[model samples]
Target: MPQWSDYTNGQRIKILRGREITQPQLAERCGLSVVTIQKAEQDKVLSLTTLLRIAGALGVDTSVILGQQAPRRAMSMDDRAMLRELSRAVHDSWVGLLPRTVAAPSADELRAAVDACWARYWEGHYAEAGAIVAPLLEAATAHRHEQPHDRQATAWGLISDAHRLAAYVANLMGARDLAYAAIGHAQEAAESAADNMRHALVTSGRAWVYLRDSRLKAALDLAEKSAVDIEPRFSRATPGELVAYGSHVNFAAVVAARLEKKERAKEFLSQSHAAGARLGEEIAAHGTRWGPVSATTQAVGVNVGLGRIGKALALADDIKDVSALSPAAQNRYSMDLALAQAHARQWDASLDTLEETLTKAPEWSRHQVLPGVIVEKVGRASTARLRRVSKLLGVSNPVTGGFDTATEKSAL
Candidate 1:
């Protein structure tokens, strides 16, 4: 049997709570949403306030929640360095004064840089993405000031996108404060741009922030309202406008799922899918990957969140190949598939899928809590595979004896 020290922070919480306390019960006690509790137990991005609430709900000291009382493995040097760089980039974007008299990159050059940053982000090269965005944000900000009025609009759009990219990366890293700062900057730039589509895009980013913070209903409302506000007449909508509207609708569907509004979620998802079909091809507009494949991939997670395990698996099957999607999106969809499979008691199949996903995107897998959650569900049957995955992800294997139930509830 593995010792308590073998478990991750999330696993420890699960162990302490025992099977008697389901996630929904724990969430209710903590005044948090079920998704928030699930994320916390998976050791995903969670705020300090959330940690404190969990500790309180479980009647445990905060050190238990932080895993400070237990001897545990430390994060790798590479991961530590990446986090430091991410924090620095977020800080710089919020505080560093813009330089005056800076020669600006041509519009084409700036566009190329933004394009590269988005590519890196989608590829799950978050640290590399961070390295590019700081300079891109500075240059765009400086250019907005230096360029003539006619060019200023273009520069503002660039600045808004750069900040939005920063927020997206920071949010993925679980840095909520940094993500908030970046979103604020994005919104400011969007206002200056005076483009309705740009404002709608920033609103979508803000909705993501709310979702991450466990404000499910708020996130859903914001996403639904923004999608409605920016709903372009499909017959005449530009590619960018279509992408923005579709992305917002997609996010709203996920939020609705978390809220357990099944019918509403389905309605939003159908709308998003229709938008994607109209586009016909995957479009990465302002870093939102909106298209048929992307919409379908998102639907898998939505189904998982809605507790439709069989439905989620069916959706996963529909996505014949995810190679065309961004690396980040591919991994996300894979996680959803694995979660659904595990819930259905297809242990071997779940392990196989997870192994393939981790191999394809090791770095991205490290930050995700789903793998850990799945391992916990499979218990002793998954020991060998779990160890390999733990070594690959540089995290501890979840202990199997924590939950009394044969099958743990889905944590999607």
Candidate 2:
């Protein structure tokens, strides 16, 4: 209900600009005339350039200015198929609808399988990841129930992770309700297992769900609290502890940046960087990764959302290598980097970054809002290049900041 999607574009801009910044102030920030700002607020047709300027000035995604993104993206066919099966597995497994005839795998085998699925997901092979987890959800659930009451903790934790994996994939594909349901089940299982590490992990996972759902305050609160609860005493902290703590604070920084609490986001970023420094390199654990690379990459995003474009670009420049990050993380960094580049008026560089993001992860890019935004800001774009990029991203009209899902389907 607090989201901006229900409002007209003009109203959304005014609201995002808020009471603190008047039209003149916004105009100054956007480097446009006050008349231009006034006309925009009057609901006149917004050129892609004007809209992109205002959206950047307001520190929001372009889609958020026009309205939220379309209720759903055009999902890849393979992803849709996998989601169908994933949805069935999530629902059936949650309601105690275990397949009676299925042979259950060992707890260790199932645990490794869930981790493998997550690895596939991070590699951006989403459908393949979903294929592994779709049936694994049911199997994990069935196996947990088969264990003796006193011996079920391991199985319970496995079920929680399996469900969490399902939620991660589903959430990215725009299956919000399914993601919520899967996460609900994941939390319940984690609680039942009484695993401290999993409790924090699930909490972080749920916070991510809240962020995608636009539950901004909830996401911030959950992430901050979970981070505090798991904060490591530097002298004695282990690698896993450091990873979880760093990931939590890094997410807290993300939410804070999005909420425009620039100073608080800065503090969290410092902590995240320190945690990463302690680890010296990326540590993959608990379905996530954290380290110097993770912290620095996320810091660029935080700076971008806070509208510190120069700072974002500076941080990005220092990140000489990103191969340590996951494929998904790399694409996401390219998104933030592109936005920073666009805001800095390095239009060519921005477009090139956008090209890299989409070419490297076309299917993964489908669900993102940033590509379309980047296209709108490319002032020097060639018609043929724009047409190709738009088709690749399925953005029929960047002026309105919405994708045509049908068009997206055909572009493939």
Candidate 3:
């Protein structure tokens, strides 16, 4: 009987890939060169970034790919049944397919429904959010059509938001094509609504889709353009406008950081911080979250991505209100904190943080990739502690297969 830990990383990749995809096909799927794919399977030079992208393209838990899964922890919004429904809803609404005759909710009711789903999404309840969003998309489309001429635009705006939510959940699920379609419809609906701020927000949303797709240059362009388009006059800016502007700049910074443009990333981050200062506390508008806490929290990740581990840790200390963030945000911060500790060679501290976060948010952690990365890089941790953490995350170490821990830098 072969345990997952018994197989080298390369062998595991080969087994998982099976006969379904050739090396070049897998290379194309991962957006890497064929030689890179070959190297990975040969266990020649597995960088954290390489493994992360590979796991993402394969739509599997990073831990599962890293090691044995005892029983795989199926997470990361990979609810096939739910996603299938969500997909059908998105495409159906886009092409005007519906239940022959549909009754549209009142504008207030429709908006409230969309808000609730967004709430669920931010709470890290991705599957729950998708379940609700499927029906909401269908109803919102109906509402957009059934509303009176004067109220039509309002209905359209709601439709845009629903699609945005769909895109977001789909993106995290690694369903890139579906995410692109959903956001495309989101932007179109926003245009029909004729709301400039809403449209700009949708553009940022699309930039995020691009970011996840490894379209760094394109993502940066869209994010920067949107930020400039809505560059608010600070003193007179409304909270919504500030949040929108902050989100765009923050994303631009994130993309810039990934692109290794240090100064550009810092510049956009500073703008985001200013916008957050003006906006004060965290707030959600147009289904997106931004404000002082979000801006600061995002800075931690930006610094981490830049390999400024000490700066990242210092920034982590400054965040006093992480409990106030949405579940997903809090989990993200925990990963950053853990990664920082791991990079500092504080292996036990990193594992402790990961253990605490995973125990608290198994569902969200299951779909994420960073946990595996953290464990992999904590090379000095005790075997017992490491195995416990590995079992918890359902990941196995690839160090024996020549994975490069020193190369654990880049987009998460």
Candidate 4:
């Protein structure tokens, strides 16, 4: 296990300083006494409230200040409820510690913390994002161990999200084995919790792993099962919850298309689009964090699958700020870009985008598998095509392979 002590005290100070605010200024912003803020900066221990306030002032979630690491053992139902209670406790403790401040957080506050982390992960900032939820996951897991099985489901669901983000970061760094290990840990957490939404996310993540390893059949099977399980559950869920599941299905469809299973791919695509439609209606009725999955974005991959390269390329302009989507969504964008380039026989452009995706992605394990497989396949395919084209054109040195401006532009 890596320790914060692994970095020199100087480096640690630098990292903190990089947050763009002085201790006294941060204290003022967070309404903390200058003495308390100075204490924290000088390595003196303060109340949890003070620490949390300082953390917030620094623009980091409280979890970042806590020395929490990866997910641990699974939980039972009572344990799950305890974890939820623990989350409440941590937040309350933070709130009560507010420098001369007080107010209990609403449900939105709790959800917002998680959502912020999600956005960070989307932007390819994994380490920072993972830190954002470390405390919540740690507290929940610790509480679950002490509690009974009554609320294990809810607790695990929450913890699984953190693990999911962790896995995504691992994947981004090209650590394939690490990525799978993280996913396994998260899967155990979700299964123990037994929440369908969490289960769907875990199952879909696993399916992507299989797809990354080129185990398309296994990927399709896992996706199919997840979609089936989630359909009936959607009616009982909020619009945002339903949209999350739809995103998972859309992810599975992309894998199916990669395997060249035309009918199966089309089938999954239909299900994915249909789910998106329903989710969109729900989001419109009750405003969601992000709008519905753009029909045009989904169609891009579908068009590429059908070999309508020009059509897919034409729609590429519809996708705005690829970095703004979730990690999975960003990966999909990269995959779609590669697929579009591949269909158009622009081998160089495809490889370039693949390289860029690999570069900008997080270091989570969950995000690793599919992207690796895609890059490997596209690289090999592109290499073969280049060789063939070179031989046919009688070019003496037809630049064997390299990333160029075309790829970087697409990645941006």
Better of 3 and 4 by lDDT: 3
RMSD of each: 11.7, 14.8, 10.2, 13.0
TM-score of each: 0.75, 0.78, 0.78, 0.54
Query: What does candidate 4's lDDT look like per residue over 56-79, in tens digits?
Result: 554433444453321111111222
* Candidate 3: worst-modelled 10 consecutive residues by lDDT: 398-407
Alpha carbon lDDT at 351, candidate 1:
79
Error of 4 at 55 (Å): 31
Against the true structure, candidate 3 reaches a TM-score of 0.78
Q: What tens digits encode model 1's per-residue C-alpha lDDT throughout 217-307?
A: 7888888888888988999988887888888888888888888899999999998998899999888876767889888999888888889
lDDT of all predictions, in order shown?
A: 0.76, 0.80, 0.80, 0.54
Q: Which residues of candidate 3, in runs, are more than 4 Å off?
A: 1-78, 148-151, 379-384, 397-412
Q: In model 4, what lDDT does residue 311 have?
A: 74
**Candidate 4 lDDT score at position 334:** 71
Query: Candidate 2's error at 388, in angstroms?
Result: 3.0
In model 2, where do residues sit more than 4 Å from their true spots?
1-71, 379-384, 398-412
How many Å off is the CA of 206 in candidate 3?
Answer: 1.5
Please report how far candidate 3 places residue 279 from its true position, in Å: 2.0
